[model samples]
Target: MHAIPVSQSLPETLDPNIFSSPSSPKVGSEPQGHITEQVQTIWNPYKNRYRVLASCILSFANGMNDSAPGALIASLERDYNIAYGTVSIIFVCNALGFIAAAFFISTLSTRIGRAKSLMISEALLMIGYTAIVTTPPFGVVAASFFVTGVGMAMNLAICQVFCANLANNTALVGAYQGAYGIGGIFGPLIATALVSRGSKWSRFYIIELCLAALNFGIAPRTFWKYEQESKSLLPQPASEQQDRERGTVKRNDRTKRQWQSFKTLMSNKPTVLGALFIFAYQGSEVAISGWIISFLVQFRHGDPSKVGFVTSGFWAGITLGRFTLSFLAHRIGERTFVFFVTVGALILELLIWFVPSIPGDSVAVAFSGLLLGPVYPCAVHVFQRLIPRKMQISSLSLIGSVGSSGGAVAPFMTGMLAQHVGTFVLHPICIGLFVCMGISWFLLPKAERRDE
Candidate 1:
């Protein structure tokens, strides 16, 4: 793509020294001119494309890591001679680690640049995966997974925030998030196929580590180049400028403002509602994705290889749905699209629950993916538009953390249900959950204005 030139509209009187350290702008200075110029430059159509690609790479990594454990759960249980309940504890630990990191590590990213935060996350992922591959004790394995979760939380929070900032037109945020869903579709299929062959699960992590490292290496050059070109296009401060030399004061103020912005985001009803949508959607998706193998093998007497294909079909449906909706959402409107998708998902889940035979069950599960795919991306698009630009990261982080928690909760619940009520009944409960989510989406107040 051709590079879009930065806007040349910055105020003439701004001190040249401001360009020296883009990291720390002077405190107590009005940022009107700087903010405007930066928005104009960074919001170019070309920059959004790069950001979308980067976001996709991050999503691909997320998929590989997220899908690996569930796919390999039976193997781990067999190797360790552990009960299903005991095995499920691994996911609990992973979720706890993600929750902790999302609350704390995500805040740190604002202080250090988003790029630096992502680099650190990738490095930690490498270390965590290495620990897992070493065949440590169960306790050690749990710790390694926990660390991986931490890295994942940071990576997810930063990438979502980065994508929001890069969006030029409000209508395209769904398209950007759709790229993430596309990654989710492929990551698990590839990971599961590798694990099924008796290949070491650690190899999957190693591959992901290499991909993340490459992304880290290449992103900075492009991001910085974009930053420089866009700098002149940013708005200048409207308030009197502080002395450019006082770096400490500027840093302190920025930190304070970020915290305050976080508070405001937490207080907003629309933000909370948007997060609930993510939480519900992810819970439904993970519950089905994580347990489908077990359901087929234990309840239907299906082979593992066939089970993997069945699960993969679901993901394939999701990928196709996301790719199509990325462009289609612009024409249909997000609210209407979300309502339609959720209702369809609800219907599909019910079909999966009621179907008695393998053919019918498989078809329902695969079709569910298409119906459920657009819910997440559209919800994210809504939240991004509702919240202010500066608060986008904190808002996305908070919602993402909640959403990840849902991912954890659903699988854990399914495992428990499988242990008690019998594996065959889990599908019905999932159908119920989708119905509730669809009802909620339908009832959610429509956006009062297009640009809100």
Candidate 2:
């Protein structure tokens, strides 16, 4: 039998399914088969710009929330008359919230859609900030952080999946993560200024509350009907359509599928390694952001007012790196770029550890932030390519949310150790975590070049 010619159409008399085989393309299916190849680029002016903008706004607020703890920790301890170990409960609660969100975010996104999920996240952040601003008991404040963490995790998982799938993903991911760095910069600055000026540490959340309120409106407006728009922009795969048409699917199965996705995510080598890499990366980042000030104040005897600015410096460097150095990741190849930066960060961390002077240590901390900054976006870009596309959202949610628990675990450990050993413990912990990052980075499977 002769092969069917591309120029010829299938006969009207014959059923198209008769020509279809598992190993062969079905008659008249070539154009439809190529639908999966179509993708949305960041340059789409009709809608993606607005979506990206909304994501950035959400990220900026998250940065402010995460970094503020560093600037406010001292004041919190003073006001509550709590020791380092006690003040660190906020990190534990925040991590618990993130871990809890990891379990439900995928389901929430599926059931309610991205827009409503994001709006709910913003609402949670607002509530958390409101609780903090009231300057309630330390336990209540810690619980408030748990609420914020749940909200932040939801936004992070959704935005990351969206940004990672766009064209020019590395650059876009960099820009997205860069927004977080910018927020981190201002978080400490505002918090420090407010505290130094005789205002309460909790007063800083007033700014965060305002930002969350803005995002609450922006998220729904920008992301409303997002799933429909995305389907229109990038048509669904035939497999996905088939899955939908199965009609046997029920709302109850969503939970089953989510658990299966988690299990599948854990079994993938790249996913597991990626999670570990983020675990180390964020662990070090938050440890430095949360503890560097105490180190400076204790070891160098630096003034609390002036030294508090160091956290802002560190975040500024992170912002600069994510924006500027991230361009190099695409050129150098994301995998190679990550190795160089991780090594650079480790060296700088050691310097921060041993350096005797406040000025030198502060500069090292900033440069360390600069080196560590692009690692996240770059790693995320690589993970997107390595993981199967269908699993990307749940995989990234696991990688981001569960992995980000390191931000809490590491800092909580640092706070506890600082109470016993002194703030100097931060440098060694950070250095060790950097080494873990290196190892995890090395273990990650190489991402193959994706077809356009």
Question: What RMSD value applies to candidate 2?
Answer: 9.2
Report the alpha-carbon TM-score of model 2 versus the true structure. 0.88
Local lDDT at 345 for model 1: 79
Model 1 segments beyond 4 Å from truth?
A: 1-52, 168-179, 224-232, 240-263, 388-392, 450-452
Q: Of the candidates shown, which would achieve the greatest lDDT relative to the real structure?
A: 2
Residue pairs in collision within model 2: none
RMSD of each: 7.2, 9.2
Query: How high a TM-score does candidate 1 get?
Result: 0.81
Minimum summed lDDT over a 10-residue window in model 1 is located at 1-10
lDDT of 2 at 416: 96
